[model samples]
Structure formats: structure tokens, C-alpha cells
Target: MGIIKKIFNKSRSPEDGIFFEEMRKILGFNPVDLSHYRKGFTHRSSNKTDENGNPINYERLEFLGDAMLGSVIAAHLFKEVPTGDEGYLTKMRSKIVSREHLNELGRDLNLIKWVESKVSAQHFGENIHGNLFEAFVGAIYLDRGFTYCEKFINKKVIVPYVDIPKLEGKVISYKSLVIEWCQKEKKQFHYDVFEDNGNEDVKHFGVRLKIDGKIVAKARATSKKKAEEKASQRAYFAFQEKINKK
Candidate 1:
């Protein structure tokens, strides 16, 4: 009876001890308390309430993760690129933490598998991975604190990829660059975005790039920004030789 009672007692812990252990393996750190990590992966769709009857989800965790990511990335860039000015360092950090890169990282790690949600995962957009990644960072901050968070960022983000020269060439937004050039050259520019009746599961926007009252390029994409950027990029390339000649 004593042994049986002990086994029952072990089974009644508020913490999912086994799950926590597995999570430690996954995160490469023994979480001091499981609640932080648990809340990190908790999707809003579950509509869960905490002990205080307040909503519980990964949103707050995401905020923390974003800040952690930026801090660590900034530190790394500052030390590595001593010659880089403020704008250069900021742009490099932005490239590393950009939504596209974060999404790719989260997807690579299959981070969403642990998310507790009432909604189907398939229904979620690509941005979910990036959000989950940020939430995970927040959880790490709450669980093990900043030192561990810095280590994780260094191991996962900086050491493997961060090529300063290559990052400098990476285009975060071609549309912004083209627009700036147009403005500088005193050329009128407009991105005429309109809905496209296309044969596809998702709705798409079509963008026409006009410069000095002439159509330079046209592109279509699932989002207005994407379409405009595509058109702008194309226009930039098409007129690159001529534009640089001036």
C-alpha cells in the first residue's frame, strides 16, 4: 500500500514531469519551471484560462522572444562588425530577424508540433512559425534567463549563418529601394494594386509599376506588398543599366 500510494503521489504533480524532461532535451536547457514553456506553445485558439482565470497563450511569450532575439542579434552584429555604422548594423539585424528568416528557422526545427490549439495547424499561415520561434525565446527568458537565451541565439542563429558581407547584399524590400531611387531622380512612381481574378486557391493582387507616367513592369502575388515588390524588382533590373548610366 505504501508503494502504491507513492506511485499515485508521483502521478499527481501539476507539472508534466516527463514532458518537461523531453522539452529540456529539445531546448538544450533544463527549464526551471515548465509553465513558461507550456504557455509559450499554447495557442490562443485553445481559449485556456490560467489559475487566475485570465487568458493564457503564447502572445506574451512572443513579445519577450522578439526582444531577446533583437538584443542578442544586435550584440553579435556590434562585436563582429566593428566597422559597421548604426544603419548598417540595424539593417543586418533586421535581415537576420526578418519575418522570412524566422519563419524558415521555426519551420526547420518543427517548432509548431508542440503547439496546443483547437484549430487545425493546416489552417494557420506561414507566419505561425516565426511567431512560435519568438514565443519560444520568451519562454527561455522566463525559464532559464538571458544567459541561456544568448547561448541559444549564438548557437542557433549566429554561428551557423551570419555572413556579414552576404547579409549586406540581401534585399529586404526591393520596392522601397526602387521608390527611393525614383524619388531621388525626380521620377513619379506609383504601385497600382488591384484584385486579380486568377485560378488559384488563394486570392492574389496584381501590381503595375508606373514610372514617369509609363508602365515599367507588372507582377502578381498573393499579397499586395509581394506583388508590388516583384514589379519593382523587375523594373529595377530592366532599367538597371540605363538607370546607372544616368
Candidate 2:
């Protein structure tokens, strides 16, 4: 029998052992303290708590993970591009640890399967993936330490991704780009956002991007931020030729 199957055969309580095996596959090392990892997957909706009644969820871990990602990515950029200025290095690190990138990482790892949430998985927003990834990183830090956390980041984030050349051209925020372009070219721009009702269960917001007295783009998303960003992204492409010139 396979080792994972044998794990079940050998252990009376197999869930922990199964999780260890699964974690080993992703982390490339056996997890020591399983509770940290379990907390990483626990959603706030689950309403779990510790012995002292401190809420048990991934939010704290996610915060730590964000800092860890920033620290590691910043260090990698410093070493990789010795000639890069602070602005250049900061921008590069932002690109690497952007919400979109982290979300993609979580999706690639299929981290949602491990999530313990009262809410339906399908209804969870895109950020959940990124949050889980960050929480996982936090769990690694707590379970092992900075050395293992750095190693994990280097193995998963740095080695496979983090191409300085490719990242240089990557846009971390289309909204920022759009605003900068408009200001530089002396073009009047505005984002008119409003509640957009849909038949779907989730509430959505709509944003209209107007530039130089003309409605340039419109987008609807679950949040105002997303809706605005989507409109900005569309506007960026619409004015791509003009925006790239400056």
C-alpha cells in the first residue's frame, strides 16, 4: 500500500497524520505542531477559540504572513538587483507579493480544500485564497521559525517565480497607473461608483470610468475596490498607446 494509505492503516486517528502527509507535500518538510496549521485553515465564520477565549482564525496568521512575504521578497529583490533604487526594489517586491499574485499562488496550491469555514466555499471571494496562503506562511513561522519560513518562501516563491526582468514590467495596481497617466497628461478623470443590484446572492458595486468628459469604461464587482480596479484596468488598455508614450 502507498505510504498515505499505510498512514491510515497504522494510525487509529488518521486525520492528523493525513494532514501531516499533505503538508509535507506542500511544505517539503513534516509539520511539527499541527495545531498551528489547523488554525491557518480556520475561517472567522467557524467561531473557534482558544482555552483563554482568544478567537481562533487565520486573520492573525495572514497578517504575519503578509509581513513575512514582504520581508522575504524585499530581501530577494535587494540581492537580485543590486543596482535597483529603493523605489525600484519596493515596486518589484510589491509586484511579487501583490494580492493578485498571492491569490494565484493559493489557487495553484488548491489551498481552499483545507479551509474550515461555516460559509460555503463557492461563495468565498477571491481574497480568501491569498489569505489562506498568508495564514499558511504564518503557520510555518509559528510551527518552525524564520529559517524554515525563509526556506519555504525561497523554495515556493523565489525559485519558481521572482524573475526580476519579468516583474519589472508587471503592473501591481492598474488604478494607480490610470490615475498617474491622467494626471501626467493633464486629462480630467473620475470614477463614479454606485451600488449595482444583481439577481445573485452577493451584493455588487459598479464603477464608471470617465476621462476627458467621456465615459471610457464600466465594470461591476463584489466590492467597490474591485469594481474600480476593473474599470481602471479597462481604461488602462483603452489608453494603452497614449499611457505607454509617457
lDDT of each: 0.82, 0.85
Candidate achieving the largest lDDT: 2
Which ten contiguous residues of candidate 1 have the minimum total lDDT?
Answer: 3-12
Model 1 lDDT tens row, 1-246: 653454345553544876666676667666666778789889999999978999999998899999999999999989998999999888889989999989966775567878899999998899999999999889899877899999888877775446564588766667888988988989999889999956533567999999988999999866787688779878877887776889
Supply the global lDDT for candidate 1. 0.82
Candidate RMSDs in order = 12.2, 10.3
User: lDDT tens digits, residues 1-246, model 2?
Assistant: 353454445543478777887888889876777789999999999999899999999999999999988888888788888899999988888888989989977876778888998999978999998999999999999988888899999998887556565576677778898899889999999999999876534567999999998999999876798789878877877777666888
TM-score of each: 0.62, 0.64
Which prediction has the highest TM-score against the true structure?
2
In candidate 1, how many Å is residue 198 off? 42
